[model samples]
Target chain A: MSIIIDEKTKLAVSGLTGREGSFHGLRNKAYGTDLVAGVTPGKGGQDVEGTPVFDTIKEAVDEAGANTSMIFVPARFAAPAINEAIDSGVETVIAITEGIPVLDMLATYWKAKEAGVRLIGPNCPGVLSPGKANVGIIPDSFFDPGPIGVVSKSGTLTYQIGNELKQAGTGNSSIVGIGGDPIVGSDFIDILKLYEADPDTELIVMVGEIGGDAEERAAEFIAAEITKPVVAYIAGFTAPPGKQMGHAGAIISGSSGTAQAKKDALEAKGVRVGESPTETAAIAVETLRG
Target chain B: MDLLEYQGKQLFAKHGIAVPSGEVADNVDDAIAAAERIGYPCAIKAQVLIGGRGKAGGVKIAKDVDEARQYASDIIGMDITGPHGEGPFRVDSVWIEGGSDIAEEYYASIILDRGEKKLLAMVSAQGGMDIEAVASANPADLTKVHIDPTKPFDAAAARSIVESAGLAEDALDEAADVLAKLAEVAREEDATLIEVNPLIVTADRNVVALDAKVTIDGNSLFRHEDLAEIADTVDDPQEQMAKEKGLTYVKLDGNVGILANGAGLCMSTLDVVAQAGGAPANFLDAGGGSKAEAIVNALEVIKSDSKVTAILFNIFGGITRCDEIAKGIVTASGQIDLDLPLVVRLDGTNFEEGLAILAEANLPNLHQEKTMLDAARRVVELAGGAS
Candidate 1:
C-alpha cells in the first residue's frame, strides 16, 4: 500500500559502473528491489555483480523492463541522464547526484512533465518503502512497514525523524526525499498528494527548511486538499538573513523565506509544526495514536 | 555568485547585449583618467554586489575631471548598506561609464522561476522603480512570461514580450534585440538571474542596459571557469578555511559551535541549540560519508573561533555511518587541544558501535547524548547557558 514505489518497482541504475552508483545500486538490489538494468554509456554489457548493464536508458527499458531509474552520474551529466530516463519512457527517475546546474534541471523538469514521468531528485537521498523496497541511499536498517508517510527536503533530517518514530514503536509507509535544491523535480505538495491518496499512510510527516516559498505553498495546498493529519518540521529558525546555510535552497532571502514565516503558514493551515526533529516525530506519533 | 554591476555588464557585453561604455577603476586617479577618456558627465558608480548603491551615495555624476576625482574618492571607500539591510559592504572599485540620454526607462530580466519550473521573463514599461512594487501596484505593467528552457527565446519571442509590457513603440525593436541577447546570456552563461533594472532608451532610440544584476548559478560555475573567477571570495577566515577543506560552513553570530552531517540536520541543530537556550556560532555540514579527516578539519575550524565555548556534533547516519563519525570525533580529540566542551549525538546506522567507540576513547571534554534535543540541552548548559 506504499506510494510511488513498492515490491513491483523494477529498477535501473544509471552510472552503475561508477563508484557511488555501484555501491548504492548493489545495496538497493541486496535490499530486494527488482534491480533489472544498469545504464552507463560506453559500459554496455558490463554487469555489476550479475545485474545487466546497458549503454542507454532505452536499452534498459526495452530489454530489462526497467520502470524506474536511479541516477548516480556526475552533476555535469546528471541532467542528460534524467532526460534520457524520461525519453526512454521510464515511469520514474530518481537522481541521487548533486550539483546539476539549475538551468539543466529547468529543461529536464519541463521534459519530464510533458512526458508524464515522475522525477525525484538531483541532490537527494532518494526514497524508501520499508521491508518491500529501498531506492537511493536511505539506510535499510531504519524502518518497517507502518502507517506514517514521510516526505522531506533534507536527507539526514528525514533519517532523524524516522529514527525517532521507530524508537516510539512506529514505522513508515514510505519515506521520500525530494531533495534540497532550489529546483527539484518533486516538491512537498507533490508527495503530500500521493500520501493523502494512499490507504496505508494515515498521517504524514513533512520536513522542510528555509529558502523558497515551497513550504508556504504546500501549506496552502494541504489546507485545501490533504485530509490526512500532517505533522511538519522546518529547520533554520535561527538562521540569519541573506546567508546560505549548506543547501543551495536553504537561505533566508530578505524576510520572505524565514522559518518563522513557514511555521506560521503551516500552523495556520492546522498542521502541527514541530520545533525540532524529535518533537516532529512525537507530534506524528501522537496524531497516529489519536 | 552575485556579480558586481561592472562584471555583469562585462558578461552582458560578451553575450552581445548592449551596456553603457565603462571602465573599472580601483582608485581616484584612474577613475578621473577613465572618466576623461570616456567624456564628461559620466557616472561614477561603486562596484559592490549589494543593491541601492545610488541611495547609499555610492553613485554620482561627474561633469569634469575635478568632479570625477571627488566622486571617485568618495565612492571608492564608501560603505553601502543594501536596501534589504544586507551589508555595509565596502566599495573597493568604481565603474565609470558615459552617461546615457534616458528618453525612456524599462525593466527586463530573465530568472529561474522555481514554482513555474521555467525561465521567467519579466518586463515593465515602468522602470527605474522597484519591480516588486510595480507588480503589486500595477500588476498589468509587469508582463510576466514563462519561457521553456528547452525552447529558444529568440528575437520574435522577445519582441512580443516587450510589446506586451507596453514599451514605447520606437524602443520595442531595440529592446527586443537586447532582451534576446539577455536571454542568451542567461542560458549560455548559466546565470540564475540576469536583471537589467533600468533598460534605458537613449535619444537616438538605442536600447542600453544601464545596470546589470547577474547571479551565475554556483553549481554550474565549474563549467564557466572564467566566470567562476569573478565570484566573491569568502571574507571570513574560518569560512575560507572550510571552503578549502571542502566542508560546507557558514559563520553565524553565536557562541555554541554546531556541526552535523546534512544541511537539514545542521540547520535543525542550530534551531534546536537556540531552542535549548544557546546561540550557534556557525553552521557546518560535514556532509554525507564524512571521514576522520573531515571531522578533524571541522573541529579545527570550530575551535579557531574564539567565541565558541561548546561544540555539538549531530550525526543521523544514512550513507554517513556513525562509526566513521565516531572515529572522526575520537581522532579529532587527539589531534586538537580542544579545551571547549564537545557534545556528540549519533543515531541511525551503526550508532551503537559508534557510541561504543566514543565511550572507549573516553575523551574528558566530550559528552555523548542519546538524542539531538538532549545533546543541544547539554551543550548549551556546558557553554554557560542561554545566549
Candidate 2:
C-alpha cells in the first residue's frame, strides 16, 4: 500500500513525444506501471514504449482511462498542460518540468485546485509508490516496499534519504517529491496529510529546504494535528541571506525559511530532527522502532 | 537582477510610461550637458542599485547647472557603505530629471503571490516612505487588486483600489488608469516584479510614474529581445565563471564549498554541512548527466574561491550516473591543486563503481563517506566546527 500511487493507478505522460517523457515512459512501463496512454499535441495516433498517444489529455483519459498524469512539457507549455490534465479529471498530476514562470504557475495552481485535482509538482521528481508503480524520475532499483513514508521538497534529496532508508533496512509506503519551485503545486502539509492517512505508513521523513513559509506552515500543521511520528531535516543551513541558492524557492529571506527556525518549529512539535538526509532515515527508523 | 534608478527610468520610457524628462550621465562633463539639456531645477539621483538614495545624500535637487555638476562630482566615484561591505561605488550614472512639485507620493507593485494564484497589484497612498515601514505600520494603507488572467483588468476593481488608496476625486481616475496600465505592462513584459516606488500626483493635477523598477522572469527571456539585451552579467565571479562553463552555480559567502549533482541532494549537502556547524560557500549543481568536464568546471569554480576551507561532494546518481560524477571528481582532483579537504558522499547507480574510481585515485585530503551523515560530519570536522 503506497501513499499516492499503486499498481492499479492509470497513468499518462503529458509530453509523451518529448525526450524526458519518452525516457520515463519506457522506464515506467518496464517497471510495470499502468502507462495506458500519453498526450502530445499533434502527435496523436503514435505510441511510445507501447503506450498509446493522444493529442490532448481529454482524449487520452477518455480512451485509456488514465487517472494520473506525469507532465514533461517545457516551461512555457507547463501551465496549459497541467490545466489540460486537471480539466481531463486526472486525480493526480506530477509535473516534472522545471522553470515554469511563477505567474503562470499561480494561475495554473488555482485552476487545478478549483478542478479538485491534486498536483505533486510542476518542477518535481514525481512520486513513487515503491516496488509497485513509480511515476517520477527516481531510480526504482533503490526503493523497497515497506512502512516508512518520505516527503521532500527536493527530488535528489528524496533519493538520498530513500537510499539511506533502504540501507537501514527500512522501506517506504511512498515517497513524494513536492518540488523546489517557489510556487509548487503541492506542499509539505498536503503530502503529510496523505502520509498520515496511509495505514502502511508508520514513520515519515520530511526533507525541506529554505525559502517561503511552507516549512513553517507545515510545522504548524504537524504540531497541531498530525499524530504520526515524523523525523525531519531542514536543508540549507549554510545558505546565505539575500542570495537565492539555485532552487527557485531556497532563500533565507527572513526568519520563516531559515534552517534553525524550521528545526526549532519542528522540534517544538516533538518531531526528531536529523542532521542530514542519511541521519533523517536513521532517526525515522529509531522513532518507528521506539 | 536589480536595476539602478537610471536603468529603471530608461525601461519606463521604453514602455511608453509617462516619466519626467531625464538624462543619465556618468561624469561631470556629461552631467553638465545633461543638466543643460533638461534645463535648470533638476533632480540628480545616484545610480547605485541599493535603495534609500535620497536619505543617503545619493539624491539631491540641483537649482542650476553648477549645482548639478557639484552633485554629480560628489556622487561619481564616491563610495557609500552598504549593510554589507563597501566597494568602489561608481556613480555609474546620474539621472537628471526635470523637477516637479509632488502633491502626494504613492506606491504600487505588480507581483506574483505564489501562495495565492493571482497577479497581485498593490497600491498605497504612502509611497516615498520605505515599503517595509508602510507594511509594518500602516498595513491598511496598502490596497491590493488581484487580477485574474482569465478575466480582463476590471476598471471598477481598479477604481475601488484607487479609492482604498485614499486618493481624491481629481486624482482617483488618473491613478486608476495608471494602475491598469502598469498591470498591462507587467503582464506584457513577463515581469516577475514591477515596482513604482513613488507614483506621484503632481501639483498640476496629473498622475505620473516617478520611478520604475522591474524584474523579468529569466525563464521567459527567450521571448523578450530587449530584456535579454539588458541582462546584468555582473554577478558573483564564481557564478559568472560557472555560467561560462554551462553549469548552474550560486555563490554564497561561506567556507565550505558544495559540489553536487541534482538540486535535491545539493540542498541536502548544504543542510548537513550547516547542521554540522559549517557554512557552504556556494551552491554548484551540476545537473544530472553532467560529464567529467562539467564536473571539473564546477569544482574549479569552488576551488578558486579563497574562502573555501573544505569541499563536500554529495551525489545521488540516477540519470546523472555516479560513475560519471566519480570520473569527474577524479579529473578535478588531478587538474586543480586544492589546498582544502575534500569529502565525498556518493550513492545510487554504479555506486560501487564510482567509489572504486575515487579509492583508486586516492587524492590527498580526499575522504569518502559511506553515507551522507559520515560525509557531512567529516566535512564539518574538517571545516573546524567545534561540535
Candidate 3:
C-alpha cells in the first residue's frame, strides 16, 4: 500500500478553471489519477478536461465522492481554499499554490490540525505514489514503483534526486515535495513518520536544503525512532551566511540554518549526508544492495 | 527585503504603533531643520539598511540645531560595516526624531518559526541592546510563545508572553499592548519579522517603539500593495533586472555561472559546483517553465560577471519542459556570443527530446553531460577547477 494516496483515492481539485489549475489538473487525469471532481465558485457545473466542476468543496465531496483535495488556487485565495478542503472533510489536502503568506498559512494550518486533516503543501509539487497514484504536479514520468521513499523540501530537487535514484535502478514507493516556504503544512518528520510505517518503503532519501531547522529535527527523530536506513542531501553548503539563496525558506540566518549545520546534525544521528545529489543516491543504492 | 530604519518606522506608524515624531532628511541642513521642527533633545540616526548604526557612530543625540548639523555632517557620509562584514553600508539619509526619556527598555518581536511551523512572539525585559547579544548572554531573559498556524494570530498569547518577561508594574500594560499590536502587524502586514529593539516605557508613562526592524515577505507581496511598493527599491541594478524578468538571482563571488529551475536545485547546483572544486559566480533560478527568453535573460546577467569562465544549466523538468530549456539554450547561444564553455544536463519528461534539440544545434563550446556530477565536473574543469 502507498502512503498519502493510492489507486482508490478520489481527488477534487479546487481552482480547476484557472490556467495552472486546468493545465496540471488535466495532466493529473492523464496520469490515471482518480480525478473525480473540480471546484470553482462561479464556474460550477462547468468542466475542465472532462472533470465535473462544483461551486464548493463540500459539493465536490458530497456529490462526487471526492476524499482528497488538491488546491491550485492563487496565493491570495490559498488560505481560504485550504480551509475549505479541511472543512469539506477531505482526509488529505495538497496546496500547490506558491507565494502564500506565512500568517495566512498559520491560520489554515491550525484549522486543518484541529480537523485532523493531512495537509501537504502551500508551495510544493505535491505527492506522487509512483504508478498507483499521482497528486499535485510531481511528474509521474520520472517515477516507478519500488522500495525507496523520496521526500524533499524543494520541487526541482525532488525531480533531480528522483532521477538519480531511478538511474541507479531503485524505484520509489512514494515521493513528496514538501514545498519551499518558511511555513508549510508538512515538514521532514511528518513524511519520515509515514515512510517509516510503510511496508513498501525499505529505505528513505530525504532531500533538504539550507534554511530552517526541519532537517536537524528530522535527524534527531530518525535517530530515536526510524529503523529504516536513510540517506540525506542538503543544498547550499557554499552559500554565504545571512542571505536568502532562492527559496523563501532556504536561507542562513546567523549560525543556525547553514548547510554545514544540517549536515552535521544528520551525520550525528548516523545518517549519511551526501555532498552532492549523485553521491546521496549512490549511498541509498549501496545501502539497499548490501 | 530588509527595510531601512525610517521605512520600518513608517510602517510601524501606519499600523498604529507609537513612534517618535520624525522625518527623513537627505542633507545636513534638512536634518537640522527637521530636528528643529521635531523639538530639541532629539535623535539623529543614519538611515542605513544594515544594523549596528549606533555602534558605527551613525547615531547621536542632539540637543540643539548646531549639534544636529554637526551630527548630520558626521553621519551622512559615514561608512558602517555590520558584523560578518555585511556592509560598508553607506549612510545616504538621516532620521531626526523627537527624543524620549526612557524609563525602561524592552525588546519585542514576532516572526515565523520554521521548525515549529508557527508564528513566534518573543519579548524580553532586557532591551536597549541587540537581541542576539541578549540571547547569548542570558537566554532566559527572552520569552518566546508560538501562535497557531491555522488560526488568526493570538494577541492574547503575545500579551501573556510579554507580561511574563517581568516588566515593571507601571510599564506592564503598555508593553503588553505593544507586543499584541506587533503580532497584529506580523499578521496584517504579511511580515516575516517585525522587531522592536527598544520598546521604551517613556518618562511620561507612554510606551513608544524607539527602533523598528521589519522584513516584509516578498512572496506575500501581491496581496499587500503597500508593502510591495516599499520592496527592494532597486538597490542593485542586476536585482532590478531580475525582478522585471521574474528570475531569482543573487550575485555572489565566484566564477562558475550556474542556473537551475527551482530554488532548492539552484542552491544545490551552487554547492555541487563548489564540491567539484569550482566557485559559483551567482545564484540564479530560471524558475519553472522557463522559456528561451528567460535563459537569454539569465545568461545576460551571468555575462555581467566577467569572473565566470564557464556556465552550467541543471534542469530537471517536471512542469518545466526540458525541450523548452534546450531551445532556450540554443536561442541564447545564437543571440549572445560567449567565449566560455557551457555544460547542459537535462532529465525527466521530454529529456530525450530536449537532448535531441540541443544535439541539433551543437553550438560552439557547448558540452552535454548525462549526469549532474559529470556536468558539474565538466564545467568546473573548464573553469580551471581541476587539479
Candidate 4:
C-alpha cells in the first residue's frame, strides 16, 4: 500500500473558488483523486465542475464524506483553515499556501498533534502517490507507481528527481514535499517514518537544503531506526553564509547549517548523499538494483 | 528583518521592557546634541546591522562635550567589516544612550525552535558574550525553556526561568519582569528573535536591556505595518533589482548565472553548476509565473551582473508550463541585447512544445539540452573553465 494517501482517500479543497485553488483542485480531480468536496466560506452550494462546495470543512466532511483537506488559502488565513480541518475531524490537512507566519504555524502544529491529524505543508507542493491520488501541486506527469519513496523540502527538486527516476525506468511509491518554510507541519523524520513503514517503498530519496537542524536530526533518526537504504541530495554546498538562498529555511546561518555539515551528518549515518539531483537518482537506482 | 540597536530598544520599550533611553542621530552634530541632552558619560554606538561594532572602534563612551563630538565623528563614517567578512558596511548613524553602571551582566532571548515547534526562551548568567560560545563552553550556564504558543506565558513562568538560570537573588524579580515583557514583544511584534545580549542589573538593582537584537518575522510583517516600514533594504544592486522585479534571487560569487522555476530547483541548479566545474554567479527563482515579461525581468537582472558569462535556465514544468517558459526565453532574448550564451533545459508538462518554440526561434546565442546535467555542463563549458 502507498503511504499517506491512496485510492480510498476522499479529498476536499479548502479554497476551491480561488485562482490557485480551482486550478490545482480541478487538476487533482482530473488526475483521478477522489476530490469529493470544496470549502469556500461564502461560496457554499456553488459547484466547482460538479464537486460539491460547502461553506466550511465540517459541512464538506458531513455532507460529502471528505476525509482529507487540500488547503490553498492565502497565507494569513492558511493556519485557521488547517485548524478548521482538524476541528472538523479530517484525518489529514495539506496546506499549499506560502508565506504563512511561523507563530500561526506553531499553534496549528500543536493543535494538529493534539488532535492526531497529519499536517503536510505550509509552503510545499504536497504529496503524490502515483497512479492513485494527487493531493497537492506536484505535477502528475512526472510520477508512476514504483518502489522508491521521495521526500523533499523543495517542490521543483522533488519533481526533478522524480523525472530522473522515471527516465531511468523506475518510479515512486509516494513523493512528499514537506515545504521550505522555517516552521512546517511535517519534517523529514515524519515522512521518513512513513516511507520506511510502507511495503511498496523499497528505497528512499531525500532532498534536503541548508538552514535548520532538521537534516542533522534526521541523520540521527535514520541511523537509529531506518533500515531502508536512503539516498539523499542536499543543495547549497557552494552557498555563502548569512545569505538566504531562495527558500526561507535555506540559509547557512553562521557555520551551523552549512551544506557540508548536513552532507557529513548524513554520510556518517551511512546514507549516500549525492552532490546533484541526477547523481542522487543514479545512486538510488543503483541501490535498488544491488 | 534585523533591527538596528535603537530600533530594537524602541520596540522593547513599547512592549514595557526596560531599555536605556537613547536617541538615533544620522549626523555627528545631532549625535553630540543628543548625547548632551541625555547627560554626560553617554555611549555612542554605531548603528549597523552587522556585529562586532565595538571591536572595530565603532563604539565609544563620551564623558564631555569634546569627547562626544570626537566619538560621534569617528563612528558616523566608520567602515566596519562584518564578522563573516561580508562587508565593510558604512555606519550611517549613531545611537547615543545614557550610560548605566552595571552590577551584573546576564543574557535573555526568545527564538523559534523549529525542532520542538515552540518558542524557545534561553536565559544565561554568562552574558556579554556570544550565546553560542556560552552554550558550547559552559552548557549548564544556559537554561533553555520551551513555551507552547497555545498556552499563556505569565510572570511566574518568567520568574522560574530567571531563577533556574542562576541569576543573583537581588536581580531575580526585575529580571523576571523583563523576561515576561520581552516574551510579550516576541509574541505581539512577530519577532523571530528578541535578544538582549547584556541584560544588566544596574548599580541601583534595576534590570535594563543594554543591547537589543530583534529580528521581526518577514512573513508576519503584513500585520505589523510600522515594523514593515523599518525593514532593511537590500544592499547589493542585483539583489535590490531582483526584489523590485519580484523574483526570489540571491547574489553569489561566481561566473555562470543560474535561473529556475522554484527555490529548490534554483538552489539545485547552483549545485549542479558547481559540480559541472562552474561557479554560479547568482540564484534566481523566476517562480511559478514564468511568463514572457517575468522571463525578460529575470534575464535583465542576471545579465546586469558583470561576472556572469553564461546563463542556464533549468525549468521543470509543474504548475509552470514549459511552453510559457520557452516563450519567455525567446521574448527575453529579443527584448534585451542578449550577449551571453544561454543553455535552456526544459522538461515535463509540454516540454516538447516549449523546445519547439525555442527551436523555431533559433536564437544564435541559445542552446538546448534535454537533461539538467547536460545543460549544466554545456553552460559551464561556455562560461570558460570551472571555478
Predicted model with the maximum TM-score: 4
Model 3, runs deviating above 4 Å: B27-29, B63-74, B77-79, B85-88, B148-159, B384-387
Docking class of 3: medium
DockQ of 4: 0.80
At residue B38, candidate 4 shows an lDDT of 98
lDDT by residue for model 1 (B121-175), tens: 9999999877788889889999999886666789988999999999999888888
Ranking by DockQ: 1, 4, 3, 2
TM-score of chain A of 1: 0.99
Pick out the ten consecutive residues of candidate 3 chain B with the lowest summed lDDT: B149-158
Counting clashing residue pairs in each candidate, in order, gives 0, 1, 7, 1
Q: State in Å the error of residue B345, model 2.
A: 2.6
Report the error of model 2 at residue B153, Å: 1.8
TM (B chain), model 2: 0.88
Interface RMSD of each: 1.1, 2.5, 1.6, 1.2
| Candidate 2 positional error at A77, Å | 2.8
Candidate rank order under TM-score: 4, 1, 3, 2
Q: Which lDDT tens digits does candidate 1 get at residues A112-211?
A: 8889999999899999999889889999687878999999999999988898899899999999999999899999999999999999999999999999
Error of 3 at A16 (Å): 2.6
Docking class of 2: medium
lDDT of 3 at A287: 95
TM for every model, in the order presented, reads 0.96, 0.91, 0.94, 0.96
lDDT score of residue A179 within candidate 4: 95
